[model samples]
Target: MSDIAAPRSSSRARNLKGGGRNRSGQTNFELYSWLFMRLSGLALVVLVLGHLFTNLMLGDGINGLDFAFVAGKWASPLWQVWDLLMLWLAMLHGTNGMRTIINDYAEKDQTRFWLKALLLTASIVIVVLGTLVIFTFDPCLDPHSTLSVCQ
Candidate 1:
């Protein structure tokens, strides 16, 4: 038998590099994205906890939640702004996380492009609709409403 040995394959050979490097070579976008995820996650924890505490722990708790309860909360400018920030941050964080997942998992260029396009479109639509709902909300807009709060 021959004494020659077969060459070993490297794990590095199977490792795939992502398109995380900026093509224009102008900025470390991936690094920023990484940092954003960490910071935003921390902020989200606080924001979400505060939101839950305010909505569920204060006053009558979850049992007091209703359309009028929501209207009362939104009537306050402070609550409106708080909710807006929460909405924007949560949507952006979720969208960015999904983008990273798609970039890492989708191998086909066309597939990746289309998937990202769909994600971006959905994100924009949700953000826009949510913002509109938050800002344009009117609890008394109904003319035939029966709720005393609406009156």
Candidate 2:
């Protein structure tokens, strides 16, 4: 290997001198997003693994998962809150992650805006629906329904 090897250079290496505000006028939003990604990713690992373990390991495992089974779990406040927390955290984390990816790759402003708009819509829809399912679920509904635990 040569002593210098032509020296390495990248966008971050060159400081933007008088470029506007960032030296290159780069907004701190990207930096904040990067930090959020790391923190959220770490949390997601724990939340997801715990979820999988509880739902697929303890007792009958995956074989036990079903509509009635879900209703029974949701009948308890603990599982309800647990699932609510999991839903919100994972949704926000995933949305922010996708935002980062979009910002990093999208070239045009309109393209970036549209992609983010779609991501936000989908995230919000899922989060709201998931939260509703966790909270408004009536385990006692339909006494004759075979699928309901209340039956």
Candidate 3:
């Protein structure tokens, strides 16, 4: 039998040359994204823990929760800022994580494009609405408001 060599596929050849050429030439985009993920994750842990401690461990704890409780909390600029940071960080972190997953799993370019578009739209809407609610929230806005806390 004569010795024979198998031909290398184009993909195998590309792999041998290192996969750096396939990038879209965005300088340090992935590096920034990776750093953001780590920093945001750490911030989220601290924010979430503080939020839980305040809501679930202070005062009457779970029994103290109600509309009036929320109104009182939002009345303070400190609490409002804390909650706003938590909301924005959580939403952005989740959106970025989902985008990474879509890029990894969605094989079709069209599918990936649409998925990311939808994700961005949803993230924007939620962030905008949440921000508005946090800033515009007024417990005493309505003169006819029935809430005892509002009075």
lDDT of 3 at 48: 98
lDDT of 3 at 74: 90
Q: Kindly indicate the candidate among 1 and 2 with the higher TM-score.
A: 1
Please provide, for model 1 over 1-151, each residue's C-alpha lDDT reduced to its tens digit, 9 standing for 90 to 100: 5876544433223232323434343357778888888888888898899999988999999999988888888989989998898898899899999999999999999999999999999999999999999989988877887767766
User: lDDT per model, in order?
Assistant: 0.85, 0.79, 0.87
Candidate 3 wrongly placed segments (more than 4 Å): 1-24, 146-150
For candidate 1, give the lDDT.
Answer: 0.85
Q: What RMSD, rounded to one decimal, does every model reach?
A: 10.8, 10.9, 9.3
TM-scores, each model vs. reference: 0.75, 0.71, 0.76
Best by TM-score: 3
Candidate 2: list runs displaced more than 4 Å: 1-32, 145-151
Mind giving the per-residue lDDT tens digits that candidate 3 earns over 38-130? 999999999999999999999999999987788988978899999999999999899999999999999999999999999999999999999
lDDT digits (tens) for residues 125-148 of candidate 2: 999999887778886676677764
Scanning candidate 1 in windows of ten residues, the lowest lDDT window is: 9-18
In angstroms, give how far residue 1 of model 3 lies from its true place: 59
